[model samples]
Target: MKTVILRSQALQGATASDLSAAVQYLIGVDGGGTGTRVRLSDRDGVLLGQGESGPSALGQGAEQAWRHIQQAVQAAAAQAGLGELDLSRCAIGLGLSGTGVEAQVEAFSALQPGYALVALDNDGFTTLLGAHGGEPGAVVAAGTGTIGEGLRRNGERAYISGWGWVCGDEGSGAWLGLKAMRHAQQALDGRAEAGALARAVWAVAGQDRATILAWCAAAGQHGYASLAPLVFDHAPNDPVAAGFVADAVSELERLAHALDPQAELPLALCGSIALRLSSEFSGTIRARCVSPRGDSAEGALHLVRSALQR
Candidate 1:
């Protein structure tokens, strides 16, 4: 995977002495099915650099997540002019997808790369932290997968959905792609009309029954999610695409309702797919929508900061 490094101006004018004397560096990671994004900072929470790498979702495998995380962290360190980063001097925070699975969480946590400090939480919870700045609110994040997280005013926490792409994660990119695949299959089998959406799926997966079958057999969650854009691109003119999007919207609303039944909490719609469908929500839900104060990577930084205080 290609690694991209970026510089940050958060502490542009600060001198070396301005950095924390204890921790040399702070790293915040947002790892999901599509990619891993990292933020490098000084202990004062001043951004130093940023980096990105391929998928690091725990569902993909702990080893895979670790490899991508290391790559991204190295890239970030390089951008910050910290050559050959010393993990032992850094405090790290991770907001990773697939934390819903206990086995996956344990496996991923076991592979920590010897940081001076480490804090980990599911991407959803971290998103909630970032969205409301750890205040009382909720967030529904949808990209390669979907999850709902909320921190109530009563200091209570709520989690909903996010069952992964295999059987759940409704309204996710993978879910939409799966629905589109089913439409294509029905069209090919003469159970439904071959529409623009079906033709588009054929172009990517296969043009015939046998090829399509072979493609499905080899496809994983990420592979299926790769087709979500096609579904969106054709939504304006394809009934099937529009139908899938409608279902996705409904699913998102359900998640919102489940998270805050009274619809009283400030809600943030996050990730590519969720943001794309934000305006489609009903009046009540839309009214509750608020822009996130920060992204998940920033929230991960909060994680490490909290860990340090403890």
Candidate 2:
């Protein structure tokens, strides 16, 4: 029965023929604030080639991000021995941030000319799709920022947290780093309990208190969030750092509860900081959550394949 269904699907695809002549390459691209990654795969989802580049979608403007995406795609295609291939022959699936803006989305959509089928969505959606193998689940990302999103079994979607750095992102690396720095500054000013946080920040920045303040004036939110690892490094021995982790875990737990009142579904943690703090953070959630099965690129490939299958 399964074989028959598979054969029928194959026949349907062949009959449709929209992508038959194009070599049916599944291309998945993930563009985030930090970087961009592209993956090329065969019809069966076997990854053929992959390439990465710096800060594609969020950091740069739409035109620049699109250019980066094109370059990464070209690099991957070339690596897969598909150099000089027609863009229209490829099925492109892009998961990107900052494209949700009307102007950006329109700009990106216009760049999809050569592809037979193109699907573009926020990178978070693709991350969730990849983490859960296209199944319904939730993901809490905690890199420069934090956000939580989930898809229920019935295809209903929910998002909890992800208010960005200033307003939200409770358990994110950015949050942790920000908190740590604040505490350190407070301590330096004799307003807070003394701990290793101040020393750690000074050490990481290789500067004294006055110099650190000057740096903060010019550094952006992400720059401060980059220091989160130092907090984790000191968590085992430093009470202030440990307190920050605990606070992060608490915030994430609140986010999980917001997504599901019952709060017992599987949640996947993505991004560098969330993964690093999983042991400490996961303990706060009663639900059965796990790490992502694959990266966003794989999820993007899955998206492309699903489009082709349809």
Candidate 3:
């Protein structure tokens, strides 16, 4: 069964003649705030090539997102010994960030260039599909930001806490990094206890408040997410850092609960920070968690295959 589904969608019109005339290829894109990745595969699901490019998140603008994806697709084709691939011969799948917004999803459809077929969905849900091999399962994507996404055995889907930093994304790498930065500030001002985490953050941003504030002001989602390892390194021994980790864990646990109250579905912790923090959830949540079978790119590929099968 295909993982990607749209409430209302129109597949790129293609006659059987067109699909049969060319040696068709499949392209899968996993586009998020940090970067974009593309996978190229044959109709039989054999991976031929892959490539990567700049950030392609929906919030980054529809034009830019497609540009990066096209670049990656081109690169992948080249790597596969097929250069400058004809779009008409390909089916593309995209699991992109920020598609949770209705407008972003519509904008995507509006701006799409012609292809033989296309499928798209929120990155979080795609990750869930990838992790579980399209089976019913859940995923907590805790990268620069966080979102809890799941698909049920019966075709239902659910999402939680994908709002950006100013609003939601409670247990994300950005959230943890922001918290660690705050602790660094407090320690410098003699307001809070500082440890390895605080020292590391303070040292990196300069030892003074003015420099630190300037760094904070300039930090974007990707920039803030980079600071998470410091907190992770010190969370066990530093009270301030520990507090941040504790809160983040609680929020993520809540994400699981919101998606599956009975915790019956298998869960996969995805993205950089969440996977690293898996050991932290030793009890209820961890008990039901498993490693993802694949990543978002595979999920996108699955969708592309599904579209072709139709």
Best by TM-score: 1
State the lDDT of candidate 1 residue by residue for 116-198, as single tens digits: 66778888887888889988999999999999998899988898998989899999999998999999999999999999999
Better-scoring candidate (lDDT), 1 or 3: 1
lDDT (tens digit, per residue) of candidate 3 on 1-310: 1234322223325454455344378888999888899999988889999999998888768998989999999899999999898786777888888887777777776776767677887788678878999899999888888988888878888888889865678899888888888888888998976678889998788789789989998887777778888887887887777788888888888888998997879999999878877888769888898989999999988866665555
Task: State how far residue 2 of model 1 sits from its true place (Å).
Answer: 33
Q: What tens-digit string does per-residue lDDT give for candidate 2 at 80-171? A: 88886566557777777654356767666555445666767667777888999989888877777676778898978776665556666788
Query: Which residue pairs show backbone clashes in model 2?
Result: 35-55, 87-114, 88-114
* lDDT of the candidates, in the order given: 0.86, 0.72, 0.81
Error of 1 at 72 (Å): 0.6
Q: In candidate 3, residue 133 scores what lDDT?
A: 90
TM-scores for every predicted model: 0.91, 0.81, 0.88
